[model samples]
Target: MYRVLRGRVNSVGFLPDERLIPYLELAGFVSAALIQTFDLRYNLISALVERWRPETHTFHFPCGECTITLEDVALQLGLPIDGNVVTGVSLISRPATLCYELLGHSPSEGKFTGLRFSWLKANFEHLSSTANEREVMQAARSYIMHLIGGVLMPDANDSMVHLMYLPLLSNLHNTRSYSWGSAVLAMLYRELCRTTDPSTMDIGGCLILLQLWALYRMPFLASISHQSYIFPLIHR
Candidate 1:
């Protein structure tokens, strides 16, 4: 499966030219490790940001589709994903294993833990520089946070709560701070209904769309992460 992505135009380059490899590598690894460790498929997790791809030749993933959840991922992996979007991670919490696999380390061959942090930090700094970088960085961070909260801190109130709250808060606000806020909100609300009471639909879904009304003034929510640099390129 990993081989299928090789020499594929480096889709990430469209967002952050310099940081593409590191983020892509981490994404591919996380997707792969999650698939193997928890038996989830890459398409589900990949689908989250896949819809926001710019109309450029460099990016390869699909765009403008429904939001993919950790639950869908777990279901695809054949794991018992129940109770909310996060409850799926309790089945396999192995950061060390996931990090090792992503960095190409073998279990008997010791661990490559430091490489994981180094890669993330380097890419983080590299991605914080411009508009496009900010969007892509946030997306990547959101993905990592999903893995961390779903798998490692499944019930942890801090990160998981914040993760859920961000979409809610963003939807309520007037500024389109992030391009995918609505998409993320949709997924969060769905999970809210799935894991809790069916009646939650009234609150989660309503709150999300209501907040997203503020997005009318903000068009960059979908492509803002990488568009900062793209506009100049187009104008030139």
Candidate 2:
């Protein structure tokens, strides 16, 4: 599939194949629509990048005393071993608000990163004040937690989760600011909370990814997502 896509960059099937125009505008719209109903909005590069952004990506915190080992939180929550899915989702979904978990404080941290704070910062720093952004991050986190708990929570809507994957992926790739990352994650969680079915699928994919990469738990691979079925030896 990837090869076919690469070979046919000019196929017009993708759209706007014009030199100055970004193919993402055309491709992204189509891609977003296809997975718009799902939780994570999977696409080859965007999905992998979103799923991997936390560990591989690092950031410089200017003035926040927020630092928590994500692994510890998952342990406390008893949600399997802290792997890429949990860690990545936590960071992305909670963003700077997660810093409170590390700061030995609570109410203040919540106040600092809540929608009000996000909104205040949005005008000045242009961070994550958008209502749409908040919705998406919330949904992503909601999806992750429900998966661990073996349940699905209701959601508000699917547009943000559906449309914002690539944008979030792009942001993660282009920025080093931790605040931005947190804001994006919160929005993602909100989107996940909007629907039950998508939340199930999203969490299912995360568990499968975790089993394959983290605990070396492979048996679940056959039952979760299709990606695990790829036999490295055969390809090699």
Candidate 3:
């Protein structure tokens, strides 16, 4: 959230949350420790931004018809997604194992946890086809707040009250197949742009733009966390 907000406020506007790895380049051990300890996937989001730059050559057809399937997209991005938009995958939660890693112990090599995107797909289907960027961002924002809430407690007045849990570390294997968090986010962005120009629907870029609206850690959040955050629940 902090990264996304900063990215929006910066001169380049919003771009892949400003590359967290760059700041940690000197601390390889810390980076390695973080990966082992938390299995965080934000790094992958940054990498996707780099690879899918507008000027960069991509397999995605911008000027022509979008003949690509979701499976192809998942494979191209190295995301561990499977099945189609109809059926969903399963991911195993591993918060306890992640806790162990922080205590100088290795995480259990258990199965990865997941969430379903079928409902997301259904939700996407129901969202107004003419949905604007702001609407997309609002959806992303609630999902993020709900995700954090699931890790501990549901946001008391959060919009996404249906979310019960989110995976930890190893459970967040790849975007969708791991936890379906980023996958659903990316899906929302994609669905919103379906009828629009392919060039404008740059997946990574669009996702970052949407993420800016999901800002939970802006500079002023300290002042508003207790009161302003509890806006009327948006049921998208």
Candidate 4:
């Protein structure tokens, strides 16, 4: 018997404040935010996972073998494929201080592990009109953090995002220099491999990209009618 994997399709409905759009663009994530709504076909995702071959990192189909590439990530999700690798210190010795510096606030000492999506929303969802430049930038960082934890690189622990990524956003202009598309692809590949195991129940990483890639490549799998082609492709 084959087990159909469940996708972790959590809601990432928060939109960035207009004030933060300029900064988000500089960080190379503004396009991704355009993909606000879509329906997840759980059965389709489960079928695809069933065909995944971990060793090859490709789906084995009767027609031919195929896989999601960096190009697919860039076009489908609008993340930067070229530039520096998306990596840094995974362990933060002083997370509180880092948060204070980049986010303008810090969790209480000894209580910091990861930032909860709820906390991000509660604090940064709305910004005052009179907010200064520093406040606007801080809110933008928090929004990006929410996107990373809730959409791009989510893991089994769905509620909180590890503080390691916060440091990367310290320089919004330089953040775009990282190959975010590559990182998203790598995480999805790892999740696909893990789901090949019979015991695995939930799938992580960007299911939106996986489903959209399949729909574009294998039109037979899609139920929606084609629309005008959009740049990011996810918006269509």
TM-score of 3: 0.22
Q: Give the TM-score of candidate 4.
A: 0.90
Top candidate (TM-score): 4
User: Which tens-of-lDDT digit does each residue in 1-236 have in candidate 1?
Assistant: 11101110101111323444344343332332133233222222222212223232122322322333434333332222332232123222443454333322222344322222223333443444454643554544434433333332233132221223222112112112222323333444443333233232121222212122212223343344233342332222
Summing lDDT over every window of 10 consecutive residues in candidate 4, give the lowest-scoring window.
Answer: 227-236
lDDT of 3 by residue, 98-198 (tens): 32332122223554332223332233323355655444433333233223322212222222222223222222212133423344334434433331333
Candidate 1 structure, TM-score to reference: 0.24
lDDT of 2 by residue, 1-236 (tens): 21100000001111211221222222212121121122221332122222232332321123222222334223322222211221233223443444232211123333221222222222222223342443333322222222222211112221112211222233322212223223323333333232123223332212222222322322433333345323331122
Worst 10 residues of 3 by lDDT: 4-13
Please tell me which model should have the higher TM-score, number 1 or number 4.
4
CA lDDT for candidate 4: 0.82
Residue 84 lDDT (model 2): 28
Compose the digit string of candidate 4's lDDT tens values, residues 169-214. Answer: 9999899999999999999999999988878899998988988898
Sort every candidate by TM-score, greatest first: 4, 1, 3, 2
Off by over 4 Å in 1: 1-17, 21-89, 103-156, 160-187, 190-210, 217-236
Q: For each candidate, what is the lDDT? A: 0.30, 0.25, 0.28, 0.82
Candidates' TM-scores? 0.24, 0.19, 0.22, 0.90
Stretches of candidate 4 off by over 4 Å are 224-236
Clashes of each: 11, 28, 4, 0
- By lDDT rank, best first, the candidates go 4, 1, 3, 2
